[model samples]
Target: MRTKLSSTIFLAILACLLWASAFVGIKIGLPYTTPLQFAGIRFFISGLIILPFCSQRRDYFRLILKNWKVVFVITLLQTFVHYSLFYTGISMVPGALGAIVVGSGPVFVAIVAHFSMPDDKMSLKKAGVILLGLTGVVLVSLERGSLSGEGKLILVGIALLILTNINSGFTNIIVAKDKDKVPPLVLSSASMIVGGLMLFLFSIPIEGLHFSAKPFEYYAALAWLSFLSAAAFSIWFTLLKRPGVKVSDLNMWKFIIPVFGAIFAWILLPDEHPDVLSIAGMIITGSSLFLLNYLNRKKIVR
Candidate 1:
């Protein structure tokens, strides 16, 4: 049990790293490829890679048919709308700023889950922590000068990203409720397949069915995003099923992602350097998330 726990933690950390790197990768890749094209191809590749690994092909299909409504709703909310908003938002705003904005997702998730999931109730302590985290995020946003000029546009983008997070939280609640009835792997696989196809269809008019870039880095970024989507999500869903791994537990490690994302964005876009205020904000954000997770875990243990 200890070994399994350790392995799960390791995989979760790996997922965090991959997810963090995705922000940077997307920023780097965007210069070479259109957002729609990037999103479409990434999902398509992810679906293809995960298709072979799916166990019980007949059962997978059967589950899809059995729960078509649930599957479609989740795919639309989690994949279609979420990725579209996120990718479009990133395209409009600076990657690090975008990361910081979206990093407040846990707070949003907590708020939404509190009302939606009885098992995931929010406490006053968690609320305080979430508020502190949001303050830190706001500080980072202000320090990045995302509150001025075309910053208004970025704010709109951030709002859209927050909506995506809310939808994701709701999707989690739905998944948690139905996890026993439907295999997570099957659900995840079908969502990707359906979601990928939807994005591909949307990309037709926006990005067209064309491939232009041949740069190694561009291809590498695409591969990374695709692999993470295809493989990492399955691992994530499995970890979610494990006892004691609450959604709140996942929020603790979320802060580390923005730090790496900010660094990577800074490296790739030298113009977007982090000021001292932004650095302090990152520290505060991390601290608050840590406290939130600690408190939640303590409550769980009791």
Candidate 2:
């Protein structure tokens, strides 16, 4: 049991870190590829890579076909809509800022899960912690600059990032409620496949399917990020489907994304640096992790 618990924690952290680094990856890769094209190609390869490992049973295929409706919804919300907003938005925003905005998704999940999931209802204490976290997010977002010129795009990007969070929250609840015969890996792979294809198709008209990059670095980034997406999605779906796990408990780890994001952005993007407000916001944001679950003392009985 101890080993299982430790492994779960490790995988959860791994998923968060992988996702956090995706901000930097997207920023680096965007100069060479269009947003949708990059995202489509990235996840398309990821889907292909992970699907085979899902299973060999024929019924698994039937299961996929059987629950195609749910799969379609998941594909739409989780992969297409979410990543469309995510990739496009992050391309315009600073990596750390994008990370901070998207990393605050747990609050959105907590609120929406209250309405959608019976097991994960909200409480006053949860609301308090959410407000605390949002306050920190506001601080970090404002630290970027005034929303006048390029800052306007930053603001729009921030809005898109928030929409991505809301989209994710809705989809997380949907996935948590799912009680089908398919494996999580199968679900992830198939959804990525269909959604990725759609995204690439959409990219054709807008970006014209053009791709250019430095010989080594472009392919290197593509492979690295594609691998991360496959691994992270598999691990995340497994964690979400695990018995006795609450969305809040799992999503709280999202806080770690910004920490990794800030660190990577500082190292990778020379123009980006965490100033006083960003640092303080991270501290407050990171501190919200402690104010949840058993640590949150509330009178309401669950």
For model 1 the local lDDT of residue 257 reads 64
lDDT (CA) per prediction = 0.72, 0.78
Pull out the clashing pairs in model 2: none
Model 1 has an lDDT value of 0.72
- Which candidate comes out best when scored by lDDT? 2
Candidate 1's TM-score reads 0.84
lDDT of 2 by residue, 1-302 (tens): 44555576678889989987876787677778778988899999999989778774456568779989888999999989998898789778875577567767988888888878888887787777777766676566656545333658888898999999989888877777774555898889889989999999988998896844366667878888898999999889888887656786678777767666766778888877778887887787767756763442232232
Candidate 1 clashing pairs?
Answer: none
Cα deviation at 200, candidate 1, in Å, is 1.5
Number of the top candidate by TM-score?
2
The residue-by-residue lDDT of candidate 1 on 1-302, one tens digit each, is 44654576577767777777787677667788677767877877777787777786768788888889888887887678888987777666765467566877877777777787667777787778777777777666665554333657777787788777787777766766665655667777788778878987897898777766478988888888898787767776777666656665555455556665666667776677888877887788778856854675565467
**Model 2 regions more than 4 Å off:** 1-7, 57-60, 89-101, 139-159, 211-213, 293-302
Query: What TM-score would every model get versus the actual structure?
Result: 0.84, 0.85
Q: How many residue pairs clash in each candidate?
A: 0, 0
